[model samples]
Target: MDIKKEWIHFIENSTEQEQEALQVFLNSLKMKRERKSLTHIASLLQLKTNLVEDKMLEMEMPNSPLLDNSIGIVHGGLTATLLDTAMGTMASLVPGNKRGAVTVELKVDFLTPGTGEKFICRAEVVHNGRQLVRMEGKVRNEKGVLIASATGTFFKLAD
Candidate 1:
């Protein structure tokens, strides 16, 4: 069967929890399709960019099974992705003749297991230079425990 037909057949036989997960994925895709202003990955991940200003960015994402690992906690890569995205946003928004920026390198330290109902990432530019920006970010769970920390370097894109 084709993709759509296969999806229908699979979802029809899925458990309630599986159906919910599929629905969330579908909604993520729908959000990306409906909003051209948001990045596809951000939309796909259902992350909300709460703040984006010069030298700082803050974002949040729901803690659900969709993003969890086999061991029942948030995946390390997802946590790193959140930190990277936040740092990149802050780096790109640096003041004084800045342009878009792309990540040159990212180093993430997983401090503790990511748990809780909601996760937040906060990033700030540690040093802003003519062509390179250095940023640091922290990820915390809903109860305010640090889950991970990251530092990233970004190179400014041309005008």
Candidate 2:
């Protein structure tokens, strides 16, 4: 099975709501692509912000050839990217006219190798401060076993 075929299979198996969510995510990616030089690598890897609440976020990505290492496991860098995106997005959701935030420090621990056909990362804001925000996130494979965990500090950007 090639990468495209695998993606098709995953989509076919997804629920209607999940497919709708994916379409919205892709539209956001398209808008971002039109405005900046950003490559949307995370989006290409199928990384998505599936849910966003007050202080919690759910993100997911489908396992694809682009995210695999030579031995057929999820690449560490790709995993890190997923964590960073989820954590950063959670931090940025802080209300008000608080400009934006950037990840000041990110630390990831690889708990287990990811070998499934899907990956999910969940992030929650641990502390939202005046100038800095802290978030913790965990990445898990399809079976719900932790593959990696991360903590990040984001510095609030200027107005």
Estimate, for each residue in 1-100, the C-alpha lDDT of model 2 and write its tens digit: 9989987998999887668667756765885678542446654665667566788998898876556688879899999998998888788778641676
lDDT measured at residue 157 in model 1 versus the true structure, 0 to 100? 90
Model 2 superposed RMSD (Cα): 8.2
lDDT of 1 by residue, 63-117 (tens): 7668889999999999999998888877777775356789999999999998999
Best by TM-score: 1
Clashes of each: 0, 0
- Candidate 2: give the clashing pairs: none
Q: What is the Cα-based lDDT of residue 136 in candidate 2?
A: 98
Residues forming the 10-long window of minimal summed lDDT in candidate 2: 35-44
Residue 109 displacement (Å), model 1: 0.6
